[model samples]
Each structure stands twice: as structure tokens, then as C-alpha cells.
Target chain A: MIKFSNVQLGYGGRPVLNALNFEIQKGDFFGIVGPNGAGKTTLLKAILGLLKPVKGEISFLNIKRGHKKRIGYVPQHASVDEIFPIKVLDMVLMGRYAKMGILKRPKKRDYTIAEEMLKNVGMEGMAEQNYRELSGGQKQRTLIARAMVGEPDTLILDEPVEGMDIQGEIAIMELIKNLHTEFTLTVILVSHDLNIMANYVKTLSIIHNNTLKLGPVDSILNEETMAKVYGAEVKIINISGQKVIISKIK
Target chain B: MNDFLINLEFFKYSIACLVLMALVCSFLSVYIVLKRIVFVSVAVTQISAAGIAIAFIAGLNPTLISLLFTFLGVAIFSIRFTERRLSNESRIGIAFVVSSAAAILLVSKSARGIHEIDDLLYGNILAATPFQIYLMIGIIACIFIVHFLFYKEFTAVTLDFEMARTSGIKARFWELMLYLTIGAAISIGMRTSGNLLITTFLIIPAANGLLIANRMKNVFIIAMTVGIISALTGFYLSYYFDLPTSPCIVATLFLILCLTLPFRFFYRKS
Candidate 1:
């Protein structure tokens, strides 16, 4: 579980998001929906401990002193160097670096876990393939494997389905869903996609206009909320318990 | 061939020195080429040369001043360019040009003649002293040791800086460390190898490795092999043909690069 208490985030003296208070429960599939420059990156950076909160504290509830929160992060874009000629399995195995001792190379156990994660992500056969050679979806899966190989308690994905085709989006989303269930992970997905947030996650958090709203999907999937958050004429309809939002520019 | 054999003993230290310089710079070339920060290499070397010129003008130690200037240059290069006003390439280009002008101006004003400029641009490798060889051995050893110890950290930061931070690694620190080591390697190599041959050692072999190998370890193997061959074979070719050593080495590397061009067109990425 993670808790943010009165967290104010920004660069310099300008506050991007102010007075944020929320708690993400364990095993919750959470989605954060925001437009560009909506302090989503700032909040994520705070969680990742890259940026310190300006005013308040964000704490991990149950993590012990010695064992910090192992957060598996899949970035918005492929951060792996395309020109490094790094192989698929080797890329995944790098996830163990934080846990490794100084001067340590990847052991057999690390490789085993990496390969198993590759298999879990359905990229077992591509382990030897160069990352530059992989398709977009395959690269995404490899990234997922890289994150999962660290055996993280929380998995944070930024714009997971961005730039993917319809099939890739669906496949990646389903893969993330299964991993969430099987691992009982606390998943935090950040995206600007309202419909995907409505359709997939159990609980959704919306950050807009320097404010944040946290609630269950049904509570947050109303037209008024969508209109206020997105600043547009919006309609929400449920198809067989799946929510879809239609937006029109005024 | 007979003359090459006769002079081999006399030039053994220089040969060993070139090979060592090539080894370290070639390894770093992977990161440089991978990150598309190839310009940083030339820029830092230029700045380091400026530092040496300053040392000659100010009557200070060249090694110390060179390292100071190299570190200063890398610090600027290490700054993450978030602002879109001037791109990283333009910024690095500015550093390159400014440092180049500074080196020339400083050398022009120094008591040492303009031929000192040539010495700075293309070092006298055949005149390398034992102290220089020992210093190179020490620096190369440190480079290799530190790199191996922090291989994952270095790779993680170079590959995905954001993800490295998220994974609890000090991404910024490692990034700065990487730039510093690269600057150090270039400066140390510049003492005898000069800017041209050092830059060649940094990019050519690594570029070839990128062309031929699909795995990171194999890429390093291929690069180190190419670098050593360039040093040894190029030295032989230089002696046999009575040509300049640096160009002979550079030309040999270029020929190898040309030989490896087909790999780039045909080699599979996956």
C-alpha cells in the first residue's frame, strides 16, 4: 500500500499539483488519467523517489526498513538504447541490478528468473533476439519482462498502450490484467486515455486543474466528471458492465 | 618486413600503449555510439587539448590541467538538456568549436612554437616514456575495473535513465560518472595518442562491433579485438611502408571499417 499525504509537487516554486492526498491499496488495479502536463509525471517521479515532495510526505505502508518497495517501472517510451545491441534476455536481466551486490554479475538464478519472466510475457523464444529487431508489442512485452524479472511488489506503467495498434493495445492490456491477478500486484497505470481507464481498472484517479479525484470506476465515470476533467462535452455509456466515454468538442 | 622486425623492440612500448588506449576507448565507444553522443567525445577531447595548451602557457602540469578541463567539459555535457531552445547537438557543437579555438589561441600565445600545436594534435607516440606507459596502465586498469564493477549500473543508466532511477539506482550519479570516465579516458589517451587517433580508437572499433555483433558482450569482444589488431597490424604496416604511425593506424582501422560495411547492410538485428 502507498499513501500520499498533502503532497505538493512541482519544479522550482511553481506548484503543478497541490495538496494531494490519497492512498493506493494493495492488489488494486489503479489508473491515473490526465492530459499532458497534468503533473502525472511529477507524481510518478515522487513515487519513484526521483523527486521529493515539496510540502508533504508519501510513504509506503507495509514495506520494512531493509526491504524497500520494489517498483517495476515500464516507461512511456522504450528507454532501452536501440543501438546498444543488447539481447532480449540480457536486457531483462539488468532489472536485477538494484538488488545485486557491488561488482556482481548476473548469476544463474538471475538468468533463470529472467528467462521465466520472458516466458511469462510470451517472449521466451525471442530471448536471443536483438531488442532492435523486436516489434513494438514484442518490445513492450520484453519491457514488461524486464520489470517483472525484478520480482516487484508494485508495477507502474506509463502510457502502456500508447502508439500501439488496436490488437497490441488489447493484448498488452490483457497481459497486464493477467499479471495483476496472478501476482496480486498493486498496479498503477498512467495514461490520458479515459475510456481505457473506465474500461479496465477497478479504481480510477483523475488529476486535472491542479486537483485529484480518487474513487471507484462507477463513481468517476459520469458525464459531469468527464466534462469537468477533460473540459469537453462528454457522454459515458456502459456496454455489458464495460464503460466507454464519448467526447465532443464544443 | 625486415625493417619492421628490427624496429619492433624499439617501438614495443608505443605499440603496447596504443593497444591499451584503444582497448579502453573502444569499450567506451559502445556507449558513445549507442547514446548518439559521439560529438561529446570530440568536444571533450578538444576541451582537454585546450587544457593542455593552458598548462603550457601557464607553466602548470599538463596532466592535471587536462583532467580539470576534461572534467569541466563533461560536467557541462552531463547536464540534461530539458529546454528545447538549443538542442544537445548544437550545444556540443558549440563546445567543440570554442574549445578548438581556445586550444589554438592558447598555443599561439605560449612560449612553445607552433610545432607544439602539431604535437598536441598528433602526439609523438614513438617518444613515449616509461612513466607515460605506467600511467596509461594505471588509468586503463582503473577504467576496466570500475566499468566491470558497475557494468549493470552503467548500462542501466545509459540505456534507460528514468527506469534506472525508478529501480533505486542513482541514475544521475552513474550518468555523471560515465561522462567523467569517458573524459578521463580521452584526456589520458590524448597525452600520447593525440586527439585524432584517440577519437578514432573510440568510434571506429565500436562502430564495427555495433555492425557485427548482436549481443553486448560479443560487441565488446569484437571491438577490443578490432582495436588490438588496429594497433598491432597498423604499427607493422606503418613501419613496413615507412608511413606516419597515426595515419597508418587510422587507415588500417578505416579499411577494417570498410570491410565491415557489408555487415551493416546484411546483418540481422534480431
Candidate 2:
């Protein structure tokens, strides 16, 4: 479980996230939905301890700061230089940095785990391929595999499906779903696409004006809530037993 | 060629300088190359050059001024250009433009008798003094110490800083080391290779090394070897032809880089 109570973070002096409170429980596939600069990424960074909250406390399943390696992260794709010369297999091995210990080369067990994780992601064939050469979806899968190699209790993904085609998106969504069930891992995803969230995740949280509203999809997918949160009119329609938001008004 | 090769002290100094520069800059080259901060180093050297030029103009010790200005540049980068604010390349570009402009302005305003800043622009490695030798040794030791102390942190931060931080490594500390290492290299090597050519030693060798090697350790070794070879060949070629040493060295390194491109293609294909 991850808990953020009264979290407030800012740059220089201005606040980005203020009086923010959210808790994620075990086996929860929570999708964080928010507009740009809604502090969704900041919230994730806050949870990861990448940014310290000036006013609040964050506790992860009773674990302290140094012991949070059980938390795996797949940051936004924009954050990394994909043109880096490293191969796909090498990136997976990097997941063992915490366990490999400082100054020690990754051991045989590390390689074994890395190989197994790549196989799990169906990227075994492209193990030695340069990271820069991989297609967008494939790179995302490889990154996911890298994160999963750490075997974390909580897996956090910030827009893991961005820049992917429809088929690629579905494949990744399915992979995440399978991984969540297989590992019984708590998954936190930040995305702007409401349809993707409604279809794949068990719960969704909309972040607006530093306030986070989290609950089941059915309860929170109403017209009033969408209008209130997104400041846009959202017409919900049942299409072949699936809830779809037909259009979002200005 | 025979006359230049026969001078034992020249040979010794050139060889020693080549080895030290190769070892230090080869390791650094990859980080700068991967980070795409070549312009940053260039900008820093220009700024440091400007600082030195200004100090010379004002009748102050240029080396002291250069060091102070280098520290100031590092500090500015640390405070204003966090990983969040700017990519390493953009930050370096900003530094490059500002410093180069400042250097030009300072040079233009100073009296003709003020020390020629061009020497600092293109280095005088063949005429390196014992003081410069000691400075090189000190810089090399610092590089080794910094790399040894923060080997994992540097690798992790270089590869993925956010991941490094999440893994409980202090990324900012290692990043500071990287920036300091670059500053130290420029400060010590600026007199040897000047601002214009220093980046060549810092980048070319490492890039050539990366063409053949995949791992970081192998990359460092291969790059150092290439750097030494180019430096030696540059020294001999310049001496024999009675040519400018720094540009000759830079050209030799560039020639080698061009030669390696075909091998890279063949290796990739195979």
C-alpha cells in the first residue's frame, strides 16, 4: 500500500500540488487521469520520493526510505534518451542495480533474471538489439520488462502507452493486466485517455486543482463528475455493454 | 620526422601527456557524448577563456581567474539547470553562446599588449611546462578518485538518473562529480589543447571507441588507446611538418574517426 497524506510540493515558491491526499491499496490497478500540469507526474514523483513534500508524510507499506526498492517505476518515455547506444538486454540488467550492490558487476543470477524478464515481455528475440532501433511499442514493452525485473510490490507507470498504435496499446494493456494478476502487484498508471482507463483499470482517479477524486469507474464516470473534473461536457453511452464517453465538450 | 622523434624529452612529454589525456578524457568523452554536452564543454572553455582574458587584461593571474570562473559556471549549472529545468545539451549551448560572446567582447576591449587569447583557444601541448604536467597529474588523480568513489552512482546517474534515485543512490552528488570532472579537465587541458580543440580530445576518442565496444569498461579502454595513438601521431606529424600542434592533433583524431566509420558499418552488418 502507498499512502500520501496532506502532501504539498512546489518549485522555488509556487505550489504545484497543495494539500493533496491519496492512498493506493493492495492489488489496486489505479489509473491517474489529469490534464497537463495537473500535478499527476508530480504526484507520482512525490510517491517515489523523487520530490520531497514540504508539509506531508508518505509511507509505503510500513517500509522506510532506503527500503523502497520493492517499488518499480516505468517513467514517461519523454524522460529518457532512446538514442542511447545500449542494447535491450543491457537495460533489463540495469534493473538489478539496487540488488547487484555498488561497484559489483551484475552476477549470473542477475543475467538469468534479466533474460527471464525479457522472455516474459516477449522481447527475447530482440535481446541484443540496440534500444534506439526498436519500434515504439517494442521499446515500451522492453521498458516494462526492465521495470518488472526488479520484482517490485508496486509498479508505477507514467503514460506507458503514449505514442503507441491501437494494437500496440491493446497489447500493452493486456500485458499490464496479466502482470498485475500474475504478480498480484499494485499498479498505478497516469494517463489522459479516459477510454483506455475505463476499459483496462479497475479504478480511476481524476486530479484537478490539487484535489484527487478516486473511486470505481461506474461511480465516477457520470456526466456531472466528468464536467466538474474536466471542465468539459462528456456524453456517456453504453456501446455493446462497454461504457464509452462519446464526446467531450469544450 | 627523424629530428622530432630523436628528442628524448619531447618524446617523453608527448607520450606522458597523451597517456594521461587519453585515460582521463576517454572516460569523460562517453558521458559527454551520450549526454550530448559537447557544446557545454565548449561553452565552459570559452567562459573560462573569457575569465582568463579579463584577468590578463586587468593585470590579474589568469589561471586563478579561470578556475574561479569555471567554479562559477558549474555553480550556475547546478542551481539553474537541474535535470528538470533543461537537458544537458541545451544548458551547454546557452553557456557556449554567452561565454564565446563574452570572450570576443573582452578580447576586443583589451589593449593589444594583453596576452594573446588565441593560444588558449588552440592549446600549446608541445610546449607544456612542468607546472602543467603537475596540474595534469592532479586532474588525472581527481578523475580516478571521483570515478572510484562514485562508480556505481555515476554509471546509474549517467544511464538513468531517476531510476538511480529510486534505487537509493544520490544522483545529484554523482551529477555534480560529472560536471566538476568536465570543469577540471577543461581547466587543466585548456592550456594544452585550447578551448577550440579540447572538445576533440574529450569526444572523438570516446566516439571511436564506442564504434567497436558495447560495454562501458571496454569503451573506456578502446577510447584511451585511440586517444593516445592520435595524440602521438599528431605530435609527430606536427613536429615533422612544422605545423600547428593542436589543429594537427585535432585533425588526426578526426581522420581516425572517419576511418572507423566503415568498420562500424561492417560490424553492424555482420
Candidate 3:
């Protein structure tokens, strides 16, 4: 479980997140949806202790400097440096750094776990290939495997499916669903695609004007909320038993 | 050829000194070339030269004066750029021009024999003392240790600083480490190769290494090897031909670079 109480985040001069309070229960697949500059990335950074919250406190369950072996992260496509000439396996093994520390090399057990995680993502074959040579979807899968190899209790993915083709997107979505069930992991995903999120994410958190609306997907997917958050009308409809959203006619 | 080889026996220490200087300089060259910090090397060399000239004028030990001025210059250079947010290129330009001018003026005014000044300018490897040899070894060891201990962080920082910070690696600390390492190397090698000839040792071998090696570890190995060869061969060639040692060493590195070019082109094509 994780808790954020009245958390405020900002750069030196401008505030981005204002007095935001939220709690993420264990084993919940939560998706945050909003337009650009919604503080989605900011929220993740604050949780990771990468940024200092201008105000308030964030606490984690059984999380110490080295004990938070349960948290993993898959950043957006633009986040990773592709120029480093690291192989897919090497990138995944980096997740083992916290456990391995400085002196100890990554053990056989670590490689075994990483290889298994790669296989689970159906990317075991590309383990030896340079990471930069992989396609966008393949890269995402490798990153996911990297996060999974750490055996994290909470996995946070920021727009992991962005810029992928339809097939790639669907594959990633299915992979997330399977990972959630297999690991019983708490997933916090930030996405722009509403329909794909609706299918898998049990809970939806919409951020706008530095405030958040938290509820189940069905309850929160509505025209009024969408207009307020995105400044546009969103029409929600069910087509072939799948939730689809048609934008409002301006 | 046999007679020349027999006569060159007195140059053994010079050859050894060149090899060691090459090792440290070339190892740092990979970063300097990649990051385009070639001018930082130029600036450090000139400022340290100026410090030496000042020491001669003030009746102080050249090595002690050089270290003091080098540290002072390093401090000013590091702090000003960090505070002003100046790019490394611009800082190097400012430091290089100002320091070189100061050195020229100080050397002109100093009451010294032209031979001693020329010896400093063209580097007398035969004159490299035991103390300097130990200093160079110590500095090189420290550089190697720093890079090894923080390999992951340094890799991330060198490739992309912002990502390294977000991924929980401290960037400022590593940047400082890099600056100090470069300063220490320049201070130690300034006496061995002088300001001008040091470039051959630093940039040439590292560039050669980059051309051949794809990985950082391999690059370091290749650089050290290239540097050592340039040093020993260059010194012997100078002794046999009765040429200037600095120019001979520089020409030796330049020849090695030329040799690597054909391989570099082929590697790219493949």
C-alpha cells in the first residue's frame, strides 16, 4: 500500500500538483488519464522519490533505501538513453542493482529470473540483441521484463504503449493484464488512450486543475467529467460489448 | 642501424616516461573527443604553463607553483561555469586564451635563460624527476579507481545526464569527479610532455581506440596500448634521428592515426 497526503509538487517557481491526496491499495490496477501537462509524470517522480514534493509527505509500506525491492518502473519511450549500447539482457539486469549492491556481481539466480521475465513477455529470443536495434514495441516489452525481473509489488508504467501500432498496443495491454494476474502486482499506469485503459484498468483517476477524481472505471467514464478534465465533450458508448468513447461534436 | 641503437641507450628513461604519460592521457582522450572537450585540455595545459612561468619569476618550485595555479584555475573554471550555466566549449575558450596570454607575458618578463624556457615549452623528458613519475602514477591510479567504482553511474551520466538523475544517480558529483581527474592528469603530465606535445599523447591514442573499440572497456585497453607504443617508439625515433622529442612523439601519434584511418573506413563500411 502507498499513501500521498496533501502532496504538492512543482519546479522552483511554478507549482504543478497542488494539495493532492490519494491512496493506492495493494493489487489495484490504477490508470491515470489526462491531457498534456496533467502532472502524470510528476506524480510518478514524486512516488519514486526522484523529486521533492513542495509540501506534505509520502510514505510507503515496508519501503527502506534498500528494502523497496518490490517497486519497479517502466518509463515512457523517450526516457531511456538508447545510445548506451546495452543489450536487452544487460538492461534487464540493471534492475538487480539494488539487490546486488556495489561489490557483488549479478548472480545466476538474477539472470534466471531476468530470462524468465523476458520469456513471459515473449521476448526471450531478443535477449542478446542490442537494445537500440529493437522496434518500439520490442523495447517496451524488454522494459516491462526489466521491471518484472525485480519482482516488484508495485509496477508503474508511464505511457508504455505510446506510438505503437494497434497490434503492438493490444499486445502490450494483454501483457499488462497477464502480468497483473500472474504477479498479483499493483499497477499504476499513465495513458492517453481511454478505451484500452477502460478495458483493463479497474480504477480510473482523472487529474485536472491540480485535483483528482478517483472512482471505478464505469462510474468515472462520463461526459461531464471528461469535459471538465479535457475541456471537450466525450461520448461514452458500448459497441460489441466493448466500451468506446466518441468525442462531442463541437 | 646497429650503431644508432647502441648510442640511444641513454634515452631509456625518456622512453619510459613517455609511455606512462601516454597511458593516462589516452585513457582520458575518449571522453574528451566524444564530448568535444579538446579545448579543456588546451586550457589546462596553458594555465599550468602560466603557473610554471610565474613560479620561475617568483623563485618558487615550478611543480608546486604549477599545482597551485592549476588548482586555482580548476576551481574558478568549475565554479564559474556551473554558476553561469556556460557550456563547456565556451569556458574552454575563455580559459585557454586568457591563460596562454598570461603565460607569454610572464615568460617574457622573467629573468631566465632561453634554454630553460625552451626546455619547459618543448618538454625535456630526460629531465622528468622521480617525484613527477610517482605523481603521474598516483593520479592515473585515482582516475582508474574513480571510473571503476562509478562505472554505471558514469556511463549514464556521460550518455544522458537528465536520465541519470531521474534514475537515482547523482550527476553533479560525477561531473566534479571528471573535472578533477582531468586537472590532475594535466598537472602531472605538463612537465613530461609540455603543453603542446601533450595533445599527441591525449587525443591521438583515444581517437584511435574509439575507431577500433565498440565498448568502453575495450576502448580503455586500446587507448592505453596505443599511448604506450607512441611514447616508447617516439622517444627512440627522436634519439636515433637527433630530432626534437616532442615533435617526434607527436609525429609518431599522427602516423598511428593515419594507419587507423583505413581500418576505420572499412569498419564503417562493414
Candidate 4:
């Protein structure tokens, strides 16, 4: 479990998300929904320890000092250079670097775990293929496998389904959903896709105007709350027991 | 050919030194090209040259001074700049120009000004000594061992810097280690191989390998092979043709890279 108490996140001393207070419980499938420049990614960076909070504190309940390896992070797929000559299996093996320790190469067991994660993500056949050759969806899955290979208790995904087709999106979301249950991981996914988040996540956090609205999806995903957060007229309709969000043009 | 063959013993030390230098530079080249730090190499080389020129003027040991200056340059350039007004590339360009100017000025004031400049630019590898050869071999061996030990960390940082940091890999420390290693290599290599040849070795082999290789490991192996082959062939060609060793090696590397262009074309087509 992770807690952000009165946390202020920022760049160059300018607060992006001010006075943020939230707690993510174990085994929770949490989604963060926000518009462009709403500091969703900044919050994730703070959690990952890549950026320190400008003010206040972020504490992991059970994670000890120097044991921050309990959380696995999958940044946006665009964060990497596609042209770099890295193979899928090698990329996944990088996940074991922390556990393998410095100066020690990955062992047979590490490779097996990486392969199993790849298989879980439906990318076992492409392990030997060049990562650049993979499609956007496949690249996302490979990144997920890389994050999951360490067998962390929590997994953080940032825009995992961006730039993918609907089919690819559904496949990746379903894969994450299954991995959450199978691996018993506390999942925190950040995206702008309200419908997917509304249906897939039990609890959702909507970041707007440097504030957070956190609760169950059904309680926080209404049209009025979404319109206020997104600054657009929005509607949430139930289709086949799934919430579909549509934003009206001005 | 008979004259060259007769005096091959005199060329032995230079050949050994160049081949070892080539191996280290070529191996380091993969990271340089992939990380897009070619200009940093240029700046570091110029700084080392400036250090040598200053030593010449001050009557100090050139190797120690050059290493010190190169480490100074590395320290400056390796710092991650937060200011957006001056980008890293622009800063490196400024460093390159300033260092080159300083070298020229200092060399002009020295006793062997023009000769020293020529040696710094093109190198005098043909007159290398056994001590330099042994020193180069030792330094290169240490670099290779360190790289072998931290290979995964290097690859991870080069491939995805942010991900490596988030994964608790001490990305900055490893990156600094990489830059320092390159600094040491360039400084030592510049003593015998000269600026132009060392820079070429640091770039062309990796560029050639990246052109043809589909995997990272192959890229490294191909790069080292390209470097050694170029060094050996260039040494022979220079001996047979009565040309400069450094230029010949650089020319050979350039030609080899050009020859691999067709393979790249075919690769993209397939």
C-alpha cells in the first residue's frame, strides 16, 4: 500500500499537483484519469521516486528503506527509442537487474521468470524478435512483461494503451486485469480514456485543477463530475453493463 | 615492401598500441553512438589536447596533465543541466572551441609549437614506445573488465535512462562511470593515436556495427571486429604505401563503413 499525505508535486518549484492526499490499498485496481497537463504523470513519477515531492511526504506502508523494489513501473512506451537494437527477452531480463544485484548476471531462474511474464503477456513467440519490430500493442506488452518479470507486489502503468487500436487496447487492458488477479498485484494505471478506466478499475482518481477526487468508479465517474474535471460536457452511458463515456463538442 | 618488411620490428610497438587502442575505442563506440554523445567525445579529445599543450608549455608530464584535464572536461559536460537556455550540445560545442583555442595558443608559446600541434592532431603512433604499449594494454584491460562486470547496467541506462533510474539502478552513477571511462580512454588514446584517429575509432566502428547488427551483443562484437581489422589493415597499407598510420586507419574505417551501406540498404528492403 502507498500513501501520499499533503504531497505537492512540481517542476522547477512550480506546484503542479498541490496538497495531494491519497492512499492506494493492497490488491486495488486503481485508475488515474485527468486531462492533458493535469500532472497525472508527475504523480506517478513521485511515486516511482524519480521525482521528490516539493512538499509533504510519500510513504509505502510495508516497504522498508532501500527496499523500494517492491513496486514495478512501466512508463509510457514513447519513453524509449524504438530504433535501439534491444531484443524482447533482453528488455524483459532488465527487470531482474535490481534483484540480480550489481556485478551478477541473470541466472536461469531469472530468464525463466522473464519468459513466463512474456508468455503471460502473449509475447512468448516474439521473445527473440527485435523490440523495434513489434507493433505498438506488442511493445506495450513487452514493457509490461519487463515490469512484471521482477514479480513486484505493485505494478504501475502509464498510458500503456495509448496509440493502440481498440482491439489492441482491449487486449492490453484485459491482460493487465488478468495479471492483477494472477500475480496478486496492486495495479495503478494512468490514462485519459474514461470509459476503459470506468469499466476496468474499481476505484478511480480524477485529477483536476491541482486537486484529486478519489472514490469508487460509480460514485466519481458521473457526467457532472467528469464535466467539471475535463471542462467539457460529458455523458456516461451503460452499454452491456459497461460504462461508455462520450464528450459533447462545444 | 622489402624495406618495410625489414624494419617491421621497429613498427611492432606502434602496431600493438594501435590495435589495443582500436579495441577499446570500438567497444566504447557502441555506447557513444547509441547515446548520441559523439560531440562529447570530440570535446573531451580537444580538452585532452589542450591539457597536453599546457603541459608542453609548463614542462609537466603530458599524460598526467592530459588525464587531469580530460577528467575536468568530463566532470563539466556530464553534469545534467537544468537550464533550457543552453542545451548540452551547445555547451559541448562551446567547450570544444574554447579548448581548441587554448591548445593553439599554448602550443604557439611552446618550444616545439607546430610539431606538437601536428602530433596532437595526427599523432606520432609510428614512433610509439614499449612503455606506452604496455600502459595502453593495461588501461584497456581495466576498462574491458569494468564494462564486462556492469554490462547490463550500461545497456539499461543507454536503452532507457528513466526506466533504469526508476528501477533503482543508480543510473547517474553508472552514467558518470561510463563518461569517466570514456574520458580515460580518450586521454590515453590521444597520447599515441592522436585526436582525429581516436575520434574516428570511437564513432565509425560502432556506426558500422549498428548499421548491420540487429542485436546489441552483435553490435558490440561487430564493432570490435571492425576496429581490429581496420587497425591491422591500415597498419599494413600504411607500411606498403608509405602513408601516415593514423590517416590510413581512419580512411580504412571510413571505407569499411561505406561498404556496409549497401548491406543497410538490403536490410531495410528485406
TM-score of model 3 (CA atoms): 0.76
User: Considering just chain B, what TM-score does every model have?
Assistant: 0.94, 0.89, 0.89, 0.97
Best-fitting candidate, scored by TM-score: 4
TM-score of each: 0.91, 0.86, 0.76, 0.93
Model 4 lDDT per residue over B1-270, tens place: 788778888888888888888999999999999998999999999999999888888889888899999999988887886555678889999999999999999998777879889999988887678888788888888999999999989988888877788777899888988998999999887868899999999999999989999898899999999999999999899888889888999999999999999989998999
Write model 1 residue lDDT over A173-209, tens digit each, in one string: 9999999999999999988878778878989988878
Preferred candidate (TM-score higher): 1 or 2 = 1
What lDDT score goes with residue A188 in model 3?
90
Worst 10 residues of 4 chain B by lDDT: B77-86
The candidate scoring highest on lDDT is: 4
Clashes of 3: 2
Chain B TM-score (model 4 vs. true structure): 0.97
lDDT of 4 by residue, A28-115 (tens): 9999989998989888888888888989999889877766647788988887787689889999999879778899998999989999
Per-residue lDDT of model 3, residues B154-236, tens digit only: 55456545434434445656655666677777777776678867766668887888777656678779878888887777777
Candidate 2, DockQ score (0 to 1): 0.34
Q: Which has the better TM-score: candidate 3, or candidate 4?
A: 4
Instruction: Put down candidate 2 lDDT per residue, B1-270, tens digits, no spaces.
Output: 567657856567655765677667777887887766666666777778878778767888766788778877866665433245656667768787878777767777767523456676776566666777777898789788878766666767777888877755667776777888877777776656677666788889888977877766777787888888887788778878889777887899899999899999999899
**List of clashing residue pairs for candidate 2:** B43-B96, B123-B194
True contacts kept of each: 0.80, 0.24, 0.09, 0.70
Assess each prediction's global lDDT (C-alpha) against the native: 0.85, 0.78, 0.77, 0.89
